[model samples]
Target: MTVVVNENRNKRARVASATHVAGCRMDLNVRDFAPMAADEPALAGGTDEGPSPLEYVTAGLAACQLVTVTKIADAMGLDYTGLRVDAEADVKFRAAQGAMSPIPRFSAARLVVRMRSPEPPERLARLEELVEERCPVSNLFLDAGIAPEVVWAIETTG
Candidate 1:
């Protein structure tokens, strides 16, 4: 019976793994962005300037975790008025204060997940466990040893 229970737990619906790909061409006074995988090669700086593909990756990690947590809460029937996640990076650098690279930054991250569920502390605790377990972004941060903090704040409106 214990074996069956464990197997069933492992059988829960889950999706893991994805392929990220993109390509860029730089040919202007200032480099412009192009689709990583475009049907036709796009001209650089012709389109409106926007975030580089790398920025998209960083945002993806944050947003993916946020959406994953929300989905888990819904699937578990946990009641919550709303939820939001804010993420920022406290990056490393090319060198120390005066090394060399001039990369301006390596990268570190800070994330805050603000949850607005009215469930008792215990229930919220369970949801936290689920998000921690299932959120790819959160797991990535944990596995990578990036410091992330999630907190609850009383909801309010004006």
Candidate 2:
């Protein structure tokens, strides 16, 4: 099948801003969307008002993968009934705290995609490949030397 290229893929600037609200807490705005907050757990000197910045990063990766998969599956004519994604990352607090450590802030990340589809495994595999290649957030992790391990669980009806 031939895939239609997006005409609006030209370069564009995206903007977001954050302001410190309190200890380890920040209020953020992105492109006129509803305001959001970020904060660390109480153990980290935060009131646990919202997810931490690291949590947002990990969640963004999962959400990006899900969106990329949906688009690629549509382009490939792959059928699916449901899709879910989970993401987690391992971070070295010492590095994030400005300690003298060789370890990167994020050491590793993993994404598990649970999909319910009737499509064949070969088709799904191709979709996975395209999603990994096209997902910007996943590429960010890879470029940072944190290779995210992506696992797909495709459930099919017998």
Q: Which lDDT tens digits does candidate 1 get at residues 1-158? A: 01112566766764433223333422222124333321212433223244444455467667976787777777777777667777665556454456543443425665667766667777667776766667676567667776456554535322
For each of the candidates, give the backbone clash count: 4, 0
Q: Report every candidate's CA lDDT.
A: 0.56, 0.86
- Model 1 is weakest, by summed lDDT over 10 consecutive residues, at 37-46
**Would you give me the overall lDDT of model 1?**
0.56
Q: Give the TM-score of each candidate.
A: 0.57, 0.89
Which candidate has the top score in lDDT? 2
For residues 94-150, what per-residue lDDT tens digits would candidate 2 score against the true structure? 434365534338989999999889888888888888888888899999999988999
Which runs in model 1 stand beyond 4 Å of their true positions? Answer: 1-48, 96-100, 103-107, 154-158
Structure candidate 1, residue pairs in collision: 22-36, 23-36, 91-108, 92-106
Question: Which 10 consecutive residues of model 2 have the lowest summed lDDT?
Answer: 95-104
